[model samples]
Target: MSLWALAWTLVFVATAMGLSMWRRLGLEKDMLIAAVRATVQLMAIGYVLKFVFRVDHAALTSAMVLLMSAVAADNASRRGQRLAGRFWRVWMAVMSTEIVTLGFLLASRVIPFQPAYVIPISGMIIGNAMVASALFLNRLRGEAQARRDEMMVLLTLGATPRQASRHVVKAAVKASMIPTIDSTKTMGLVQLPGMMTGQIIAGADPIQAVRYQLLIVFALIASAAFTTMVLGALTYGRLFNEYLQPVV
Candidate 1:
């Protein structure tokens, strides 16, 4: 946790870059860039979070959460370049999912509405939703391309665009959600999740940590499902043209 200890962590990044070079993988530059970006971004967020935690105002906390969600949506939207209006589609999906999940939790008093609790939990929710959105976009595009002929045939047979692409949409949503479901199933048995591990390391009770982890895991499942479903619905329509032909 000291500067000296943090500096030692760079050895891992150096080793990764060295391995990439030794293997002729042509990824040394990318590895270096990623390492530097991670360091700078984390340090910057650390300071910002320190300030937020100190101020602890509801308006500032809401603004921070909205900013995080916007950034996440932007990052995920890159994967859906083929889709029209990809950014707003992703932004709406992520924003709706975050609002519904966090709103419910806060209204129900399942979690406190303070910066210390809301900000971290919002990060996890928004982050997972971002990943889910990326996965949905990737799978949807791949499936649509692979099934282009079948989709065309269905359209020729007078099937509605939605009906023709139903299978692809469902499959993409399912594929996107599978990882979240699998990780939750294997939780403590496969890995100690970061939230729980951090709490335990910070001297919290194991039982308390377990409870918090469960809450997060459940929230994540909801987040993934909502993100995938909303994104799939929003994006599938964009894949068709005015003539009901597949465009993607």
Candidate 2:
């Protein structure tokens, strides 16, 4: 079977968007637009990759990594700015997450150099970081806003920003980590993960497929956890007062 064997994606997208509209879920228009945008974007990306992969140049590979970083930063900054103070801080959060994740993955050989490995793994890492950053940053901001009074009280009592924002920090960490946690918990129980299923479908040994799937899952969790902690720590610190104190 080819990659296009996943034609059910279109049907699922249509069904979801349609159901959202019918149910007046407020997400209907956004979902429809997102689906359209994703299609167009992926189509363009497919052609780009076709061209990009033909070149075996080092500069080309670096360019691809840079582009991935920029896109990841854009996705994250768009989500983070409303809550994270300056645009630069959001960029820092995004970049930090990306660096920590990509660094370890590359070093560990969980993902390697060729455009095939580079593109797919980068996409997953960037996507996960984008999500974790968005959720952690937004939630931290919201909690800080809501609990400003309590935080200020703590500050007044000689607590540092780190200490005062401890509650919000914990919540942010939990929020960011939830997806990784759930994926691990549900790995072989509620559903067969796509990587394992894809490998088996491709005629690989079931044991081999299971091994690759386990590696991918663990790598994903590690990358996400690293992203969440770095972004959360960076952002939570800034949300507090200038005196290293939590704000009111």
Best by TM-score: 1
Best by lDDT: 1
lDDT of each: 0.93, 0.73
The sequence of per-residue lDDT tens digits that candidate 2 reaches over residues 1-248 is 35586666678888987888888887977887898899789889888888888875657866877777677767776765645453455456656655666677688887676777676666676677677777777777778888888888888898877788888888877888798789789889999988788779889999998987776677678767777777666676777656665542
Off by over 4 Å in 2: 1-36, 84-87, 200-206, 243-248
Q: How does model 2 score by TM-score? A: 0.76
Clash count in backbone of candidate 2: 0
Give lDDT: candidate 1, residue 23: 91
What lDDT would candidate 1 get against the real structure?
0.93
Tell me each candidate's TM-score. Answer: 0.91, 0.76
For candidate 1, the TM-score is: 0.91
Query: What ranges in model 1 sit over 4 Å off?
Result: 14-32
Residue pairs with backbone atoms closer than 3 Å in model 2 (clashes): none
